[model samples]
Target: MLIDTHCHLDFPDFAAERDDIVARAHAAGVKQMITISTRVRKFPEILAIAEKYPTVFCSVGTHPHNADEELDIPVSELIELARHPRVVAIGEAGLDYFYDNAPREAQAIGLRNHIAAARETGLPLVIHSRSADEDMAAILTEETGKGAFPFLLHCFSSGPELARVGVELGGYVSFSGILTFPKSEELREIARTVPLERMLVETDAPYLAPKPFRGKRNEPAYVAHTAAVLAETVGVSAEEIARITTENAFRIFSKMPRV
Candidate 1:
């Protein structure tokens, strides 16, 4: 079985046929999925999706792109919200200099808040970093030094230094469909070196669809394709790759039941 450790089922892209999407996922051997929240304000929408499907779970955190708007959200509130049975992790949060849609300082402050929430609640932080590796690595390293917190560099396409630092800090690194692209040789190289136990597979769906599906809308069902490529990159059987990643998912999102 496979678990899509990260996805965005709440997005409008899936609105027209959400139930069918989940059905297809289960049919594709994706036993479970986590629908990530990009903003706490819409958490009810995210939660509704998880609540509607027994195999689906969710996280609540502000994406860096909306960090400035959510800066006022309290860490205490994040901790409180995470108390729910289906809330398994925190943040799709981190730096995103590639877009610069939000100020860098605001993004940093927001990331720290999510980190604090993760540290306090023992939930893995779902990090997103792009074009801001140095600051991202430095902040993650610094915050982790204060006290360890479980986290994953979700949909990772960062510099090797940041990947190295995250792994060194006992954090996980997830690969998305981007790894399957012909031009992602460098990313595949990094994937080869990331310890098998710390690796995870995600689609970051409604975004980076895998090879044959590239340029089209992505969904949880497509994660199987990413897993297949990950298996090749990791030098293991497709079944072994699925087993390892699903195991890693349970280890990090300990709140989720093993069934």
Candidate 2:
């Protein structure tokens, strides 16, 4: 069985046919999915999706793009909200200089707050880093020193140095549909070297659909395509890739019940 470790099934893109999308995912061998949260304030919507689907779980954190709006959302509140049975990880948060939709400073501050919540709750931090590797690594290093916490670089599109540092820091690296791009050979090399025990796969659905399916909306069912490419890149059977990555995901988000 496969699991789309990170997706946005809660997004409006699935509002009209959410059940169909999820049913298709299950039909395609996707046993579970984590509908990631982008803003703490919108957590109810995220949680609602998880509650409605037994195969779905939720994460609670502010995305870097929404950092400014949620910078004031206390870590304690995040911890409190995360106690829910359906909430598994704490984020989709980190720095995103590529967009800079939120001030860089605010992004950094909010990331630190997320780190605090993760450390306090002993829940994994689901991080998003884009064009801001140095600062992201620096903060993760500093925050881990304060207290150990699990974390995963979701839909990772960073440099080898950051990938190296992330694994060395005991964190996992999750690949997305972007890995299937023809120009992503370099990223594929990195994926190849990632230890199987510390690697994962995601679709980041409603965006970044894999090749043949590229330039189109993505969803959990397409994670199989990404996994097939990863299996070829990493020299493993797709079934093996499915088993291990699913196990890695469960290890990071222990709060999520196995399907």
Q: How do the predictions measure up, each by TM-score?
A: 0.99, 0.99
Worst lDDT window (10 residues) for model 1? 250-259
Best model number under lDDT: 1
Predictions in order: lDDT: 0.95, 0.93
lDDT of 2 by residue, 143-166 (tens): 888878999998989999899989
TM-score for predicted model 2 compared with the true structure: 0.99
lDDT value, candidate 2, whole model: 0.93
Tens digits of per-residue lDDT, candidate 1, 155-219, equal 99987888899999999999999999999999999998899999999989999999999999999
Please report, as a residue range, the 10-residue window in candidate 2 with the lowest summed lDDT.
Answer: 139-148
**lDDT of model 2 at position 51:** 96
Model 2 spans > 4 angstroms off: none
